[model samples]
Target: MDERVTVLKKQIRAVVVAGGTDEITYQSEWLGYLPFPVDHWVEYQGKTFSGDFPFDWTLDDLASLERTGFLEKLEAYENPEDRFDRCIRYRVHIGCA
Candidate 1:
C-alpha cells in the first residue's frame, strides 16, 4: 500500500472514532490550480481515466481502503458542468481497524 494511503486510513480512523460516525465523504476543489502533479492515470473497469491533483491520489487511496475492507463506497457524484462539484460517500468499517 502507498504511504499516502496508510496516512489517510489513519486519519479517517481517528475522525470516525472521535465523531462516532461510520460514514465519511471525500471531496476537493480547484485541483487543476494546485501545484501538485496533474498528470495521473487510472484504469478502472478496463477504462483508462485521467485526473488532476487530489483526484488522482484520492481515488486510488479510497479504492485501496475498499479493497482492504476498511471502507465501502456508498455512492459517488460528479457534475460535468462543475468539475469541483463532486463527492464520494463511504462507510468506514471500524472493525477493520
Candidate 2:
C-alpha cells in the first residue's frame, strides 16, 4: 500500500476513535459514504467554503478528482488532538466531478 494511503487510514481511524460524526449532506451521487463531518474550511477565489469528503474514497480517487481541480484538501483539520478534528476534509467542487 502507498504510504500516503496508510497515513490517511490512520488519520481516519483517529477521527472515528475520537467520536467524529457525519454532519454534512451528501454532495455527490458518485461520491458516497462520508463517515465524518464536513467541518473544515478553505479559501478559494477569495471566498471561504466547506465541503464533504467521501469516507470510502481512496487516495487514487482523490488524485483523479484533484487533477480536474475539483477537490481541495483542508490540512488544518488533520489534528487528532482536537475533538472536532476528523479525517482530511476534501472541498469537493460540486457538479464538476
Candidate 3:
C-alpha cells in the first residue's frame, strides 16, 4: 500500500474534525471542501461549500478515493494553463459554517 497516502489521509481526517478554514481553488471558488466524498456539498452566497465527507467517501484518502466517483466533477486542463492545473489534486472543505 501507499504509506504516504495513508499518512496524508490521517492528517486530513484530523484537519476535518478540528473545524477550521481552508481555501481550495479549482476553476471556480469552492469553500469548505472536503477531500473526502462523504462530505456534504452545498452552495452558499455565491460560492460552493462541501461539509463533511459522505458515508461512502469517508474512509477514502487521496489514493483510495474512487477515481471516477466525484473526481469527474473536477475541471481538467491539458498542459495546464496555470500551476494548479497541472497537478493532480482534490479540494478539501474544512470547518463548519
Candidate 4:
C-alpha cells in the first residue's frame, strides 16, 4: 500500500483504539461505503454542517472535510473508549485478506 494510505489507516485505527468513533463517511468519493444520512443541517461559525459520511475517505479527504467545517461538531458524547474497545475488537480480528 502507499505510505500515506498506510499511515492514515494506522492513525484511524489508533483513534478507534483510543475510544474515538472512527467510522468512514460516505458522502464524498473518499472511500466505497454505504451512505449514512443526516436529518437536519446546522450552521455554525458562518459555515453549514451536516452529518453525511463521505464516501471513500482518505486522510486528504478528511482534512478537506475538516477544513470545510464538516467535522466542527464532532465530539465524544459517551464513554466511547469502552464502546471502541468492544467494537474495535471485531476489526482487530479481521485479516487483511
Best by lDDT: 1
lDDT by residue for model 2 over 1-97, one digit each (tens)?
Answer: 3455444434433343444431111121122237744343322333332223334554465455456655555442334454443344455444442
In model 4, which regions exceed 4 Å deviation? 20-22, 26-97
Report residue 13 deviation for candidate 2 (angstroms).
24
- Residue pairs clashing, model 1: none
* Poorly placed runs, candidate 1 (over 4 Å): 31-57
Taken over the whole model, the C-alpha lDDT of each candidate is 0.66, 0.40, 0.36, 0.32
Model 2 TM-score on a 0 to 1 scale: 0.29
- The candidate, 3 or 4, that scores higher on lDDT is 3
Task: Tell me the tens digit of each residue's lDDT in model 4 across 51-85.
Answer: 22233334354444344433332332323443211
How high is each candidate's TM-score? 0.64, 0.29, 0.31, 0.27
Q: Model 1 over residues 1-97: C-alpha lDDT tens digits? A: 7777777777677666766557776664455665854333332222232232233365678889999999898888877986766667788898895
TM-score between candidate 1 and the true structure: 0.64
Considering only N, C-alpha and C atoms within 3 Å, which residue pairs clash in candidate 2?
none
- The residue ranges of model 2 lying beyond 4 angstroms of the native Cα positions read 1-57, 76-86
Instruction: Write the number of the candidate with greater lDDT, choosing between 2 and 3.
Output: 2
RMSD (Cα, Å) for all candidates, in order, is: 9.4, 14.6, 13.0, 14.6
Ranked by TM-score, the better of candidates 1 and 2 is 1
